[model samples]
Target: MAKHGFKAIEALDITYVLPTYARARVAFVKGKGARLQDTQGRDYIDFGSGIGVASLGHSHKALQKALKKSAKTLIHTSNLYYIEPQAKLAARLVEYYKRGDEGKPNTQKSDKSKWRVFFGNSGAEANECAIKIARKYGQKDGRYKIITLDSSFHGRTIATLKATGQDKFHKHFAPFPDGFVRAKDLSDIPNKLDSETAAVFIELVQGEGGINALDKKQVQHLAKILKKQNILLMVDEVQSGIYRSGEIFASKVYGIEPDVITMAKGLAGGVPIGACMTRLIDVFESGDHGSTFGGNFLSTNAGLAVLKTLEKMRKDRTLESTTKYFHTKLDSVLERYPAVFSKRVGLGLMCGLQVRSEEIFSQILSACLRHRVLVLRSGGNVLRFLPPLTITKSEIDEGFTRLLCALKELKISQTQKTAQKSKNPK
Candidate 1:
């Protein structure tokens, strides 16, 4: 440790941090809408979008301007007082669900009720907020358990890690707080919920758990049942919201108006912003919960910019058509790799493929990076593609082309490995 204690560490010193992330070799130095460059100046076509945080893409002009403006004026302040940008962002999200485009809904009186939003720093924090509210809502009734679906992801925080349904995330952190349990299956939700249940949390599309999408009919059915029972229905749109799944939120696509919804990852473009929105009645009292840096001036400004950008995209219908074209291109690519991919799944830009084997999946991922096409992996096997919503049809085509080349390289490598094994007879 040196004097001037906490200065930023250089790349060589990154090992000083916790070994939480299995970081990639290359460090991106700069980026454009759908392109990125490493510190070595090597260019790459981006499909991962920084795991969906770069909604409008890296260093977008709007984001830069927003950041600069906020920095010049106010970057952060306490949440004890009202922040204009924070309130505006919350209003924008509420209005999004209340009214559709052009100030019209399917009918005059839909869910025009009030919604309150709480901001946080990341997806996990947003989810943690949701869990706390849910738990608090049941405190008087002695109901605190939350029901989450199998293979669903909440976040990495202690409360959220416990809320997550995957067993692998439960290890090495023994004794996760009580009140979180996993459902046996979608068909078993009704039976699994008990008097101790406070809420049912779901991801319309399980982004980290292989981008698995819940059935619309079953989801709506469950929502109805929960509503009648006065149980809260919560939707976690951390990876599939902010138009990533063709709609403002996949919850909108599912047509399920949940009592609570948590969103992040792409809310403020690349800026760190997470929010938990819920019905007015579901909101916690002032002393129940609060965040120190949540809804700060900077993040709220970024959020406002993102909402404005998303609204413009919706008006132009660019994301809709781009999403359609992306799926079509991915279809052609999948058709060519029948044996490597079991099937394709997902909606809008949140697409993924079911790999035939884990080896092929890893090989495909490594090849994509080597070929200058960035992507992500999910569920330990899926090749997840979550490009910026601003990606154009041509960009989608180009990215897919690069991905196809990587796929070829993977197949060739696998073939060579097979040959070597046969020769050695090992």
Candidate 2:
């Protein structure tokens, strides 16, 4: 960790107890929209978007009001009672993705049944529920193996860590679940499938896997193959859902319907809530998987508010068009610095730029911090941009100006080093 000049009390040694995060030096005390203020009142242009959780931006009034009102009314009831907010939120969510008419829905629906929701408190928990459902779905047929892509990222839980395709996350957390298999590409999946295979899980855009996106054909083909094999299709949308990818869900852009969808992060506008919404909601028994605080009154209220705001943003074209404009500006800026950045990849606001090396990324990140612009590194060598969907053109231009100035400084530093090396005859 790069040490910032903040003094710490010996009593505040909790950081040593928890795992270390690649955190910035400055401490943020307040945030609004796309701007954050540090302890010393220095302002920063936030491109991290709280790691893709603040879709409506920090401290949104809608979310705040909902949270406060719900808190005053009721916070937790242990899921024993029929919580009105939870039921209402789930109904709203189902209506958003419900197919056909109410009585004559689709093939997945039962004659007398409705879509069901299983909620949790975080992305990992959401994924854990999906994993459990998939396992049970195939437990009868002896099909338990899960096929994930080479560069896909799911979550940090034991099941999700095993589901994660990158080998780096698998270190030391050995002896993961037995039914997981990693594939180089979708074609590699066919060879790995057997009677023990249960489902295929993937990230539409591999956020931690360098922000690389699967080809539309690759995804569609995988979905087809999984359907043929009776293997469930699970899309991990924890990072890509809730308008982060311009669409409400990344699967919409890919033109595929997953059997199960896991969503979190932006679901509640920074409040902790994760959910597994699936067409096959009846696969698991009632006691197979559950959570105590999953769909409590407060979180559900916040989720409803968040969804309403996003739906409004989507209809008004404020979120999607703004994100598209910002992406275009990013591409134009990157074209002017091709030597420093080779390529950029992403969909809408969920974007990443691949730098030449980890060293370059670190240098640029340090420079961004110095200039009071906050950004995050994704998939080792790419700088991920998760700016608020509500950010304006002026904010984009200002952030880009700071970023370009940092790049220019790095370029000059490299040139000076080359000149010094020539003079020293090394």
Candidate 3:
């Protein structure tokens, strides 16, 4: 690559691509494990993990082999016939869900025959499927409303966008699909629900809404209330599932089993895939819902590989040990920079540091990028960290070392700016 290689690529993207994402100024050409290499050959420790999509990290051997084998055998034959990989992957997800259900105390025992899976291409699609199931289940009683918590994010599609509780996302799209309402807080849920209410959707650990985890007791109580009312409970695990929260699903961490669970992001370890798992098997009948490329061989095979790898990690306690080590390092950083970081938020690997202000957050983000440590930003001035579940203690140490240096640089820069402002005050 030339000295101006990234600039050339950026120029091409500006010309051809939609300006939807505020992309960083670097172009990564290669990656291995938790490290990525830019066109300039500089390596960066991947703490963001492509916004929690690259669960197994980049170029994982198991995922690569599975993809290769599937590509050679069959990639897509539509959903007309039976797909072996898709069936196997669904079974694996069901197995995990069942185990999670059985491990918890006082929870309802899962009926394997009553549970089912629906495949899609993204989190939005999976959530859309869940919404359909809720509507269908409630149609007999004339119920269609789905209540969502404030600061929740579902997706960008019309229906899911309406389902998102954030007012910012509701802008620019007029007259969204009806039947979705937002609850100000957990306590407001019952007041909002009526005979028309069908389900309640939530993210146990709100990801884009500042990495905030809901109160466990409140969530459990809400689950019991919904169960007693016969209203469905849907969990959006799009960003917190697949061991990102040190558990297979964040719902398990909260000790509640939702009626509908929608997952994606890290499911296939980078391949695009989404799944909607539900306990209400009879909600959708034949010809009710279908996807053309939902259960294709390529995506499902990749999903199976990720499932196998994560299963091994779970059995060996690799996820547990790594999550503990990462949080410990995070707490050390927070303790050392109390003035910069107000507090630590979220659970396990899906965590964040709430900074002093949005300005400080932006400065720290830029400084970290300059120091070649990738991170993410969330709501409420948070520096979100969604590292790969396979990240090592050494990688954690390396990332934090650069992060501390970035913080120091930001402090120096801010001090200089303050001194300059004092000198030039009107």
The alpha-carbon RMSD values of the candidates against the true structure, listed in the order shown, are: 4.8, 4.9, 4.2
Candidate 1 or 2, higher TM-score? 1
Q: RMSD of model 3, in Å?
A: 4.2
Every candidate's lDDT: 0.84, 0.81, 0.88
Error of 1 at 323 (Å): 0.2
| Residue pairs of candidate 2 with colliding backbone atoms | 143-196, 144-196
lDDT of 1 by residue, 1-426 (tens): 222222233444575767678877777667888998776677899999999889998888898999999989999888978899999998888888786645465466655566788998899988998888888887888889899988889998888898888999989998789888789667788998888889999899999888898889999999999989878899999999998987787888897889889999999987788899898454576677778888999999998898889778887888788888888877777667666776788888899888878778778888998989999989887888999988877777778889988887775455645654554453
TM-score ranking from best to worst? 3, 1, 2
Question: Which regions of candidate 2 deviate over 4 angstroms?
Answer: 1-6, 9-17, 99-114, 411-426
Which 10 consecutive positions of candidate 2 have the poorest summed lDDT? 1-10
lDDT against true structure, model 2: 0.81
Estimate the TM-score of every prediction: 0.92, 0.91, 0.94
Query: How should the candidates be ordered by lDDT, best one leading?
Result: 3, 1, 2
What is the Cα-based lDDT of residue 89 in candidate 2? 81
> 1-426, model 3: which lDDT tens digit per residue?
446699899999999999989998999988888999999999999999999999999999999999999878999999889999999999888777767433433345555446789999999999999999999999999999999988899999999999988888888997988899899888899999899999999999889899998999999999999999999999999999988887788888888879999999999988889999999988888899999989799999999999889878877889889988888888888776666777899987899999876677878989999999999988868899999888888888999999988987765356645653554453
Q: Global lDDT for candidate 1?
A: 0.84
**Using TM-score as the measure, which candidate wins?**
3
Q: Which stretches of candidate 1 lie over 4 Å from their true place?
A: 1-11, 101-107, 412-426
Better of 2 and 3 by TM-score: 3
